[model samples]
Target: MERIASVDEIPTKGVLFDYKEGPFDEQGILVRTRDGFKAFKNECRHLPMRLDDREPADIWDPHGRYLVCNSHGARYRPDDGLCVSGPCEGSHLKELPVVVKGDEVYLETDKIGGFFNV
Candidate 1:
């Protein structure tokens, strides 16, 4: 397991990208949803392009409902990383297995699925 970010760094309703320089490889995100922290690959399902153009938390839709893909307006459910509406509808984001211990967020690097290819 690799600690990525502290729980205080991520808001309860915001998201943050784990830079490549961190313990994890490749671009990934840690979202603080209503339920709790959820992680996923930063790549959009449409292509290898990144999903957020700016800060991850500011890339939501007009109503600030879903996570909107800045490149294509692909709205995804932060709770499950599911693309409910967009060119890639029905597809889902590659979720990362994460666990929060104390005040730090960590990812089970060794258990990352092959879909990430990290």
Candidate 2:
């Protein structure tokens, strides 16, 4: 994992940001969870499409509970990237470990896996 952006770089709330994990890393978003901060791969489990591929790159609802993929309106939990609705109901968003050091945010590339790699 390497430092990419800071908390300020990401929107205060209900905002999504695209982050890099490594050379072969997948695109992800840094979210502000009620417990703290978390990240999830932008790719959707239903297909190889990135959630942000839809018109709105960031589709977090006002309540900020889950991220909605604009492509097919799929909703996923930010905490663990679990799907709650849409075609991929039984699937989950690939979770990426993220660490916030001081004011900088780092994505943990070593543990990247789940729906995609499988």
Number of the top-ranking candidate, with lDDT as the measure: 1
How would you encode candidate 1's per-residue C-alpha lDDT over 18-111 as one tens digit per residue?
5442444577777877777888888889877778764553566777667778887787898899999889998888888889999988877668
Clashing pairs in 2: 81-93
User: Each prediction's Cα RMSD?
Assistant: 4.6, 5.0
Error of 1 at 27 (Å): 1.0
TM accuracy, model 2: 0.73
Runs of candidate 1 exceeding 4 Å displacement: 19-25, 53-57, 113-118
Residue pairs with backbone atoms closer than 3 Å in model 1 (clashes): none
Cα lDDT of candidate 1 equals 0.74
Q: Which ten residues in a row have the lowest lDDT in candidate 1?
A: 109-118
lDDT of 2 by residue, 10-91 (tens): 7764334444444454566677777778777678898888876867666776576678888898888876778899999979
RMSD of 1: 4.6
Model-by-model lDDT, in order? 0.74, 0.70
